[model samples]
Target: MRLNPLGDFIDDDTFALLQQHRLFDAKSVRDFQIRKTYREMRKKMTASDALDKLQELHPYLQYDTIRKIVYMSKAS
Candidate 1:
């Protein structure tokens, strides 16, 4: 069985909101926002540049998380 990476972190309210929006439960809204940022950054910049820009925009997120999202989007 596949396990949701965000399962441990998602709260009841978040899950309800996701259900209402027909969004996948695997990622939270914040996670989706970060991924969206990564995707936008990947469009005009190198992965490193994208990661740097995303980190600058969201200093609270860890570097590795931004890097992973940027790289994964590249792979797709």
Candidate 2:
């Protein structure tokens, strides 16, 4: 069986919001270019240049958020 990616962190309100948006119980976020883009960013960019490059690669993706999610999930 599949569980939520955020699992217990997903409270009733967030679940309801997802359901209301016709999205429910998803386990993974799709279409992120983290590995590919971050690698390239690492190649030519320093910290100051990262955000601009990342935005070019993915406008909607927030690096810190994804990092936190993956980091927390994997740490457990």
Strongest candidate by TM-score: 1
List of clashing residue pairs for candidate 2: none
- Per-residue lDDT of model 2, residues 19-67, tens digit only: 6797843334432234434556667877447655655655675777545
Candidate 2, residue 2: the lDDT equals 28
lDDT of each: 0.68, 0.53
Kindly report which residue stretches of model 1 are placed more than 4 angstroms away from their true locations once superposed: 1-27, 69-76
lDDT of 1 by residue, 11-70 (tens): 767767876798874444456666766778778998788788888987987899777654
Per-model TM against the reference: 0.51, 0.36
Relative to the true structure, candidate 1 reaches a TM of: 0.51
Q: Which stretches of candidate 2 lie over 4 Å from their true place?
A: 1-32, 66-74
